[model samples]
Target: MTPTAASERTHLVFDRALVRRRLARAAWLGAEPFLLERAAEDMADRLAAVKRRFETAVDLGTPTDAVARALAGHAAVGHLMRAAPLAAGAPDVVADEEALPFAPGTLDLVVSALSLQMANDLPGVLAQVRRTLRPDGLFLAALLGGSSLTELRQAFAIAESETTGGISPRVAPFADVRDLGALLQRAGFALPVTDVDRVVVRYSSPFTLFSDLRRMGAANALAERRRVPLRRATLLRAAEVYAERFADPDGKVRATFEIVFLSGWAPHESQQKPLRPGSARMRLAEALGAKEVPLPPSGDERD
Candidate 1:
């Protein structure tokens, strides 16, 4: 099938081209600093914890240079490069996550910060990352999680339903921790792990939150998102709903940003593996020092 036909067959979620444009505009307008600082610091800490030096590494599609800056002069990193989907961040190369430009087994490490959540073909991207890593190489990433932006989503839904009698997807869908862990394993990574860090940010109002999102290049880019501008009345109602529902006693509205971290290593012979089922030398009952009990037989067994 032609590439166009294949894309049509695939259930494309985010419009990647639009995403790039948004990010470029954000950069041109000087996006807010420290939007991804926490994630970058966490990534640096995680890498530091792993007592190994990566001879070659790439920062994949991070919207900002925070990750690169955080790892600069790090003892664990050598010859680090940055790859971005757009030319916004002065990256070492402009490369799309959907199609990485790395040779197989060429990289020792790959790190993505708050970027993979925008990928339409995330599993495919993960597979490509795995193929680019040398045996026992590491891939560490942070992205928005399913619980991210729950407040905005709910407020928008309520407002749109009441005003327009219909609702559109204003917030992009993010994968849950379990789903991401499974994706890592499917992408041929060993010892896959996933964890979440929920950050509840207090905003003066929903409008402030919206502005922050635009500055962070995280505005809606969903494929099925409404093309028309949001109606002013709808926006007001959304703000009202947000304030009424999610505002704290101190009058600050809450915005949730759940960052999910993923880490896995390319499989190697020396990597630890789970023991085969029923291969245990000792029974579970013996190991636990518990009395064994037999269950009643099923109908077939009784017969």
Candidate 2:
């Protein structure tokens, strides 16, 4: 889609009330506590691995105390800051990734944990991130990706098709690894890497999974949408469809969480440059001793 079209669609898809309700439910579901602890652990591990390389770091979309915990052991304490607001105890400074307040090339490192999936314009946000990094600066992020919540998507699709005769866009679409890598390249990030980690959790019923998602502040956030209450019959039918299609033989439904980890670097003049043309370039066809395939000339290039 064109940028304008995408922006309009994103505005229509994001529902603030749905997000608030999901956050409230997620807090009640103890997702905040669990996520905070996880973030702390991950940050500590990440810091230990890259402390010698980086002198400054920013945690984008860090919504809990994890960023603080991650920076606690780093010598760059003064440079550590968060970019999202949280509860009173959480470490945050209320920032958005799309329009970071930091000056260009000011950051040495940027980390995001389980964030960025909510961004309306992920590529634009990545560009902003790229602009904030110094040459050779590192960018690391984790976000929910495709293959996540397959059971939920299937269940919702079945329910809507059978009940409403149409499917509503409930869950936000996530980027696959390939698409995410391309986006990083498009944003001018160097040596971009993308990896997926699949986490499967079992639930006794579909309701249990739904409840967990709500507690995690993950729900439908589409704006300009109807808010009709789900009927009992529809709910039961959804549950049945979920169990029959997504359940294991043990009767528990499996929910897949595909976490995508990405890392890249800011371009630098000192970095290795591409080889000059006509210099020894490795051609796959030549290496394989295969005949070169002729391409159809464009209208402009035709003889």
Candidate 3:
């Protein structure tokens, strides 16, 4: 395989494992019941109105439990769950977003929640998603954005810089809404839309926030990096700094999760076309009717 293709495959493998670990952690975090219940409720409400519009629907990166609940609630639409390690589920098959195993134009709807941001080649994955959807098919996704872990990131940065004299790139970078919208357009998604919602949770201390992240299985797993054991002294210093800088007036530490929601449709042939050539062109300079005067020629140009 070509280098690019090999890289893509590697990314898919890594992302799949990462997400599976996270899901498993979430399952053990005592929050799976609540999270899956909320997910099922939300999916049922959203798909109720549009369930009849699509013939085949797929949930990318869906957990087994969540998918089961969603399928039970929305039995009208054909549902297929996709995720790494294939979790124990009733999904059509295990597949990766960077390269879906479906035939082109086979799907009518694709839904993903808080999953796409973890992709190494997000644009390529989106392109694949676009290809899988039938013409005029709907695409809906939610992803954690740059603002998702501000407090945790701040604490880490402070600790590393103070203790080690430098910082480590442990956390993955996230795309903003504007950049994500531009990527959607580049991937040929029509009528693309993007919006962000902020969810804040308060913690008693920075250590509690770290514990939650670990339990959520959202720990950093950079491809090219070493995992050094964190020192207790450094961790304590980090907690102190985090509390001092990020604590609210009520003395609670807040962690923010900025989620970006996206929706788009595959272009259809029946959509309106552009105007014919030379038909009512509107140039800004011409509309302003500005005059252009020639300047004196340079010495090299003058004969």
Candidate 4:
């Protein structure tokens, strides 16, 4: 499985320092963390579906600490440790998104909500998660993904190109569902699975959506981002374009937020494995009640 163009830029484009600073500011604002709350709710549903219990668990960089609250009453979780990036709020642990500090096979479970999308080395991050998990340990996570913020990206690109004669990278790219699943399996995790949940939130205007993104610490923090602030003309023009194109009957603009959830487990002897391809007792043609036709012709002979 190949990573999308967006995924390819993680190491080259995202400014890690800028992302941390934005998240720190977002935490200080202490506004309504609707996105985190929603992600937390979905993670809880996933956690509930698992039949086994975890003796030790961690919440990795959940901005509003919503996941901790979600797991508070969960019987499967015996202990909960909350952590954030080095620049973010206080937590039981201070971990870098790129390199987690856990010893091998120490964690029984790890769950993250609305984080991991910004990781510079996503493959390395997945590897670290797999290494930390004990055999049969589970990792459940959610992050922004496919078609997220299409309207905003388009508006910004159009405005900048029109007003400034060039466009700057305004939005960080997110991983698609298939890429995430591939990364999980590549990280040595077993039973990897991924899916998405689309959340379309309406706002009075695109500016209001921008405000909420500010509160969520979701800012354009690309390393290659334009150093100069967006010109007032560009900002206003972008708003105009956004309203014209995305506004609904009520004059509210639409913002698409796609959350991708990934589930994987550390490899273990007890987990089910696929049988060998040729080991099937039934023949493919016989199983399908079809006659097999035999034909042999080399390319040279045919030509």
Model 1 scores a C-alpha lDDT of 0.90
Please provide, for model 3 over 1-303, each residue's C-alpha lDDT reduced to its tens digit, 9 standing for 90 to 100: 533484556544234565666656665664323333444455566667653567687878655455446656465566555543343243566665556676779998888765667777787778888988999888877777888787777887888789888787656677888999999999899988788778788888877877776655566755543467777777787888889988999899988888787878889986555678788678655788977566788677754
lDDT of 2 by residue, 45-67 (tens): 76567545677888887545555
Q: Could you estimate the TM-score for every candidate?
A: 0.94, 0.80, 0.78, 0.91
Predicted candidate 4 versus true structure: per-residue lDDT over 71-187, tens digit per residue: 897978889998778555667898766668888899999999877888888887788888889999999999899689999999988888899899888888888888999999899
User: Best candidate, TM-score-wise?
Assistant: 1
In model 4, which residue pairs have backbone atoms overlapping below 3 Å? none
Q: Count steric clashes of candidate 2.
A: 4
Tens digit of lDDT per residue, candidate 1, span 1-303? 423344456687998888998898788877865648999999999999998899999999999889999999998999999998654578888888777888999999999999999877787789889999999999999999999999999999999999999999999999999999999999889999999999999999888988888888888899999999999999999999999999999999999999999999999999899999989999889999999999787676653
User: What order do candidates take by lDDT, descending?
Assistant: 1, 4, 2, 3
Q: Using TM-score, rank the candidates from best to worst.
A: 1, 4, 2, 3
Q: Candidate 3, overall lDDT? A: 0.70
Q: What TM value does model 4 have?
A: 0.91
**Model 1 alpha-carbon drift over 4 Å, by segment:** 1-8, 300-303
Better of 1 and 3 by TM-score: 1
Deviation from native of the Cα of residue 12 in model 3, angstroms: 9.9
How big is the positional error of residue 218 in model 2, measured in Å on the Cα after superposition? 0.6
Higher-ranked by TM-score: 3 or 4: 4
Number of the top lDDT candidate: 1
Candidate 3 clash pair list: none
